[model samples]
Target: MHGQTTFLNWNKERIALERIKSLDPIAHGYMDTPYYVAYSGGKDSDVLRILFELSGVKYDLVHNHTTVDAPETVHYVRSIPGVIISKPEITMWDLIVKKRMPPTRIVRYCCTELKERGGQDRFVATGVRWAESVGRKAKRNSLEIISPRMKDKIVLNADNDESRRMFETCSLQGKRVLNPIIDWTDDDVWEFLRYYGCRSNPLYGCGFKRIGCIGCPMAQDHERLRVFGRYPQYRAIYIHAFNRMLAARRADGLPTDWQTEQQVFDWWVHSTRRRREVEDQIRLSEVAI
Candidate 1:
């Protein structure tokens, strides 16, 4: 598996290197700041780090410690030298209690507050691929100007990058990012990683496909259940946090159907409909506020 890039006739590796080298100037103008590479302790981030090194560009591999990441992921991230571990001020458990709600697919406030924080006003690099999800492909771009307001985000595709000078200006107000592997396939990622002899996160060896947060809302029921089974302590932590959240709600005269943390935990892990309803209720409450 290690020397298969040529047997597969893979050229995206070369393309990715070119993309990073080409985008190097965006990292520094008169400033000495380099690209903030978002390293998530996943295979893609590993590939991105390797590509940056191969391209010989200045970059800092930064991992946003969501506090809910699997033990394996944290350990994997630590094993990588020069990776800047950026921990959030608040842990996921505390965040759930503070928000008085669990993170759901409809509104993952946790992601905004934890995983997607940092790299502000700096050029960034991510290993996001269109193959991951349709939502990402639709929202993310090869080159993007981060907006103070997300709705006003600026996307400069390879063809539209002629306005790069203007795109550089937008970075002054917010940030900019380049997705070097935006067009790469899953095969491309695994092939490139193998060629570089990267075994990636240990979770992958244990039959885990995606290794990010332990109980991400984005994960399917079976995947969540599997991770929880492997690390039941995380389930306990979440339930305990939910109990605190319910307590907070009651103290504030907020409405909730969950009488016990067990009830909330079951709904969180099993009931997608209930979670969506809660998200809707949350949105309504915000409107009322």
Candidate 2:
């Protein structure tokens, strides 16, 4: 099956390159307009970088630092040639305190603030694969233009009617978002990486299925555990943040059932399993503070 999938993927790769070549005018106004890649320093992103080079398209690369990423991943991204490393205004720890609650899968404000802040007014390419998630599969188009105003509103967290109208009337052209390998699968990503001998993040070799923020609630319990166990310093930072959040809640006359930092950390990493229990505890201490 792997061999067959690889064979099919090679053909698909050729077709995808042709498709991107044909979109030069629509994506960048001309063949010479350089596009940008939102490189993640992961397997898929490495493949995307190579794909852009192979496609003979003029492009640059950008990697937004989430701050919560593994040290090895950050090092790897920094080591990449000519990659622009963009950092968020606030660190993940500070964002956690400002949010007043841990980021859950449903409310991933971090992505908007950290990950998707790139490609503001320029043509940007990404390594988004339809196979990665159902949401991306349904929502992402292979090639689409993002209004510069809308992009600004998203990154700036401004979502008012006036802002919308202002953006709608803005004279600046919208940015183009290109997903060159949107149709590729996991097997295809690894195959391409091996073929090119690309050096990906070292965290993958340490048994992480994906490389992103450590202790991210969206991760599975096993993955999260491995991350916490592997990186004690980050785990300590997360626990301290949780401790501070709980203290603030207590000071505000809210539920403070999870008293210790350890308790808060335990509940946080395993909260999904006991969602009702955690929610009920929070509800029990509700007050107009």
Which candidate number would show the highest lDDT if scored against the true structure? 1
Model 2 local distance difference test score: 0.74
List all candidate RMSDs to the true structure: 5.5, 7.9
**Which ranges in model 1 have alpha carbons more than 4 Å from their true place?**
1-9, 26-31, 159-165, 169-172, 273-289
The residue pairs that clash in candidate 1, if any, are: none
Per-model TM-score, in order, reads 0.89, 0.78
Model 2 steric clash pairs: none
Q: Give the per-residue lDDT of model 1 (tens digit) for 1-289.
A: 3664452525777777766776675444633588899999898888898888888788889999999999888888999989999989899999998998999887799998999999887788998889999888788778888768676778777435575555655534567788888998878788788887887999889888887798898888778888899899999999989989999999999999989999988888876656667999999999999
Best by TM-score: 1
Write the residue-wise lDDT of candidate 2 on 48-106 in tens digits: 88777778866778899998878898889889888999989998877877777778889
Worst 10 residues of 1 by lDDT: 1-10
